[model samples]
Target: MATETFLASFGLVGLRLIERHGIDPAHFARELGIPSTALPDARTRLPSALLDSAFEKAARCIPDPAFALGAAECWHPSHLGTLGYAWLSSGSLRTALKRMARYTKTLGQRMSSRCVETPEGLQFIYDHGRGDTLTGWVMADFGLSLIVSLCRTNDGTDLAPALVTLRRPTPATIRPYEDFFGGPVRFGETHDGLLLSWQVADRPLPTSNRELATTCDAILASELATLQNDDLESRCRAHLLHELTSGEPSDTRLAESLGLSTRTLQRKLAALGLSYRGLLEKTRYELALRYLDDPKKSVTEITFLLGFSEQSAFTRAFKRWNGKAPSDYRQSPGS
Candidate 1:
């Protein structure tokens, strides 16, 4: 059974905000039974219950109801470990957000988030998957505001979500949220999320760095694999997902990225009844289906995205994976 928890680095961010408002950081940590030493290590794990208590306590001691939103300003690229850097270097807001959705579980065990395409734009929804409490409310505020902040940081356009939705009832004052998000906010809704217009979501950011983003993404996948129980196969698949956009990764390249020799990597896979080619094929097949779902991408674009040398090769593989061609599969009834 996985226990709910948050990365200690997040706790550190919250504590710093508490201290900025005149609370003693040491005292806060001590009250929550957190070791002073643990606060300095980004890799440390903090119990979600402790964080919940800390937020509840902060809500009581702090005069402002929106104090947790201060975390939006406090975040640094280091705060989220590798994911933060990966986000900073992402090609676009859409890519960064997808990275967040994929790896948020590494930040908090209970952080369940997704990005859905809607006619209006991309909707990023985050549900902590816990009962309503002061902690949940605080986290919701922090989570939403922090996303906006990150977008502004990388985009340099002060980009605001098209709209904001919340499960919580309307607060005593909506000014703070509206002011923080720089747009209209809807409360008492069925979900908690932000809607980003496609224009801003897909726009190329000035901070885009394909090389660095790819590097950080690889590390994040490896870290996620560790958090998910050190599964080498999972690690391989995750790494491949990030690498596919660049090109089909050779076994030597993949093994070197994972800090293993090619022979060792193959030996380990064989022991588990797996093969490098089989995993690569599976990865490409899975990604092909996802890309095909998006009509914006042409078959040629998807061919390169899947690291295939030509459209013919991809079509052949698609035929093998499914009984029909990619176009046929996409147009078939239900598809």
Candidate 2:
């Protein structure tokens, strides 16, 4: 299976910062095992481990302790791919922050983000499974600084967080931390996170553009889906989704689409303790729920979309999967 990776746009941001500090990014790239060519392509995926190593190398070689904080200055929405655009067009900081937590996988699977409500404000917590080490502090700072920068970019205000906490111990100099966060900085905290008062998070932004946000949301969803389906089973399901509208995709057609012989495809599925028929059923069920979510798609239309010969057949499959009829499930998706 492919290793967890992130888009190269982030590395590019770091490279730009490196060059700004009078260091050669190419030298750092070679040391970090990153291809010089990969730095310019936003969509190129690089291993997550390399990102951690990059921060570590920078901490060792860079004279400035807070150099990673400059990530905000070099950041552009395009670096984050679709998620960046989705965040830019969000109506409010709350919406934008939640979208970051939601589609974070598009950046790197190892990192996870969450927004929690509190008496003081909304707390945005991020864990990339590396905040305990000395070098990890740089990564944490990079993340928090980028958040503040993106907020300023969209809201056109020097919005400050209510509070900021880093798991790393206090550095020799602290002014940079306070200036970047625009709030009180506390060190040696349980989590590397920041808090935004509800007033700031929920207030509508002047940059609010629902049409663009919605378009970006769809693209982000698609990007995430493609990123997640790296295995053979998922590859088959993706091909099946495109072919389903024509009819039930035969194993022969699917195998051909995947550049495999029918017998070879069957053998491979069996090795993984799966079957071709089972894959088709699961793919149809997955697509069925998505189609049902569209109120405009009638049951009959969705039936054909799943390549079912009859509405009754689709209904039976839907019920078998969810223990509820398609219409009922659509009405109460949580059920």
Best by TM-score: 1
lDDT at residue 87 of model 1 (Cα atoms): 84
Q: What lDDT score is found at residue 161 in candidate 2?
A: 91
Our tally of clashes for model 1 stands at 0
Candidate 1's C-alpha lDDT? Answer: 0.81
Q: In order, what is each prediction's RMSD in angstroms?
A: 8.9, 7.5
TM-score of each: 0.72, 0.69
Cα lDDT of model 2 by residue, 34-115, tens digit: 7673545656788988888877877887888888899999888877887888788877787788879877888887788998
Q: What lDDT does candidate 2 reach at residue 325?
A: 93
TM-score of 1: 0.72
Q: How does residue 237 of candidate 1 score in lDDT?
A: 84
- CA lDDT scores, all candidates in order: 0.81, 0.81
Per-residue alpha-carbon lDDT of candidate 1 for residues 76-177, written as tens digits (9 for 90 to 100): 877788788878887778878887987887788778788998899989999876657667777888788788889999899778889999877788988888
Task: Tell me which residue pairs clash in candidate 2.
Answer: none
- What shift in Å separates residue 296 of candidate 1 from its native position after superposition? 24
